[model samples]
Target: MQIRLGGLETSEVAALLAEHVEDMRRYSPPESVHTLDLDRLRTPDLTFWSLWQEDVVLGCAALRELDPTHGELKSMRTSHAHRRRRVAAALLDHVVAEARRRGYARLSLETGSPAEFAPARTMYAAYGFTPCDAFGPYVADDFSMFMTLDLADQPAR
Candidate 1:
């Protein structure tokens, strides 16, 4: 699989993001949905990436710069056809490596608190992301679970 930056223009990537948004809505209330739309993911503060196997999009993820030393993970999703193939893990590894390269002292993310999100929460925990107070523009909410990794303590890959 190849991980490419800025593939959001492709229909596959757009559909994948749309699916992500739809899934988020199914698990959370409208006001608690934090998923970014396609346009927002294209902003300057965010770096988007798509994982591909030749011509097919396998997954996608984005890193948003909250500040020079802090970043947030967004839009992480694996295609339905590609689920359980380690697609999300590969994209996550790529994002974490890129964050460390960017000198980010911390990497954070917000995911649903519903049971449907348990697998995701487990993955984040395996990556050393622990529960944390809301950061960036987010506030504490029952529908959202915040997690963070202190990159400063992580050794370079």
Candidate 2:
């Protein structure tokens, strides 16, 4: 899969993002839903990417800068047809590599606590992300699982 920077013009990316928000709404309470909307993804500090194979969009993910040295993983979703094929993994590797290039020491993310999110949590763990307390605008919530990875221990990509 080829991973590259994306913009709002990518309809597949927008569709996947909508699916992500809808899924979050289904699994999380309104007050606890933390996914960013399309507009927010356009922020200067957020770098969005899409994974594609030929003309097909496999998935999309984004990195939102929480600070100069830290970033939050956002909107990570692999298309249903692309699931179980390492699409998400590729997107994640791309994000982590970019974070390292941007001089970020830490990469953190928040996902749902439900069984529906088990695969996502597992994916994060496989990439060396360890559970952590809520960072940024988040508070400790039983329905949320927070994780972080330290870039210091990682070699250049």
Best by TM-score: 1
lDDT of residue 113 for candidate 1: 96
lDDT of 1: 0.94
Q: Which ten residues in a row have the lowest lDDT in candidate 2?
A: 4-13
All candidates: TM-score:
0.97, 0.94
- Give the C-alpha lDDT of model 2: 0.89
Q: How would you encode candidate 2's per-residue C-alpha lDDT over 79-124 as one tens digit per residue?
A: 8878999898888988998899899999999999989999999989
How many clashes in each structure? 0, 0
The C-alpha RMSD of each candidate to the native structure, in angstroms, is: 0.9, 1.3
Residue 75 miss distance in model 1 (angstroms): 0.6
Whole-model Cα lDDT per candidate? 0.94, 0.89
The sequence of per-residue lDDT tens digits that candidate 1 reaches over residues 1-157 is 9999989889999888888989999989999999998889989999999999999999999999999999999999998899999999999999999999999999999999999999999999989899999999998999999999999887654
Worst 10 residues of 1 by lDDT: 148-157
Question: Which segments of model 1 are wrong by more than 4 Å?
Answer: none
